[model samples]
Target: MKEYKYTINGTKYEVAVGDIEENIVTVTVNGEEYKVEMEKEAEPEKKKPVLGKPAAAAASTSDEPATNKAAVNKNNAVKAPLPGVITDIKVAVGDEVQVGDTIVVLEAMKMANNLQAEKAGKVTAVCVKIGESVMEDDALVVIE
Candidate 1:
């Protein structure tokens, strides 16, 4: 059972909800008890669509030869830590960055996160733009 107090038009009312079984519920208001029948089940709120590379694609890359992976990663590509949309790019091509410098602002799970540089280098490529979505491990920038 749950209790709630509400004030409307300067009048205070106490409500208690008890025994909700399917569409029917036992409810009490003030000092009166009644059985209430819900008109219909409440629809759940819609969720935002998740856009990015699927897990299978990310897993398949691990099966490639180590040499090929190392060659591609030699440029110091700064990858996304998680799936998110690029809210802002703090650096651009040719920009110099030191370790721990903020490189990009990513929005994930309704929070903005500052993605920092892992190593000092000059930016050679900006792989994603503001509003572009990226998956975990997707390169957002490349430095050399």
Candidate 2:
């Protein structure tokens, strides 16, 4: 099954699509299952990418890093307080920032939350881009 997480009207939903047939699909939304009919038959598709536990474990067993999702650049880093999409980044690399400065804006639960600098420092790295979804405690920017 293919899974997708979405936030709509401030509500979060996890949808799984699978067992597709001619013009019908099975979808599970937030634990509730539904059989949906499509307007037309879906076209043949290519293979899906593999990006799950097995692949990650295989990568970790090798010399290379398991993934690039958890990179930290500096000792000082601003992390996401909750799961959300990064709507904007106010500071660029080498930009000086003071405590309480709004470094980034995150959209969660249909609200805009400002991510501020914890201390005065220069921005060393921006780890997320616009429209990127971040999880709680994910490092957003590094300051030094």
- Candidate 1 lDDT (Cα, 0 to 1): 0.79
Candidate 1 structure quality by residue, lDDT tens digits, 1-144: 999999999999999999988889999999899999989966899966434335324534554323344445534798999999877778877899999999988999999899999999998777766666789998888778
TM of each candidate vs. truth: 0.50, 0.51
TM-score of 2: 0.51
Clashes of each: 0, 0
Q: What is the C-alpha lDDT of each candidate?
A: 0.79, 0.79
Query: Among these predicted structures, which one has the highest TM-score?
Result: 2
Error of 2 at 115 (Å): 0.8
Candidate 1's displacement at residue 84, Å, is: 0.5
Tens-place lDDT digits, model 2, residues 67-117 = 323565545789999999877778887899999999998889878899999
Residue-level lDDT for 130 in candidate 1: 66
Quote the lDDT for 92 in model 2.
81
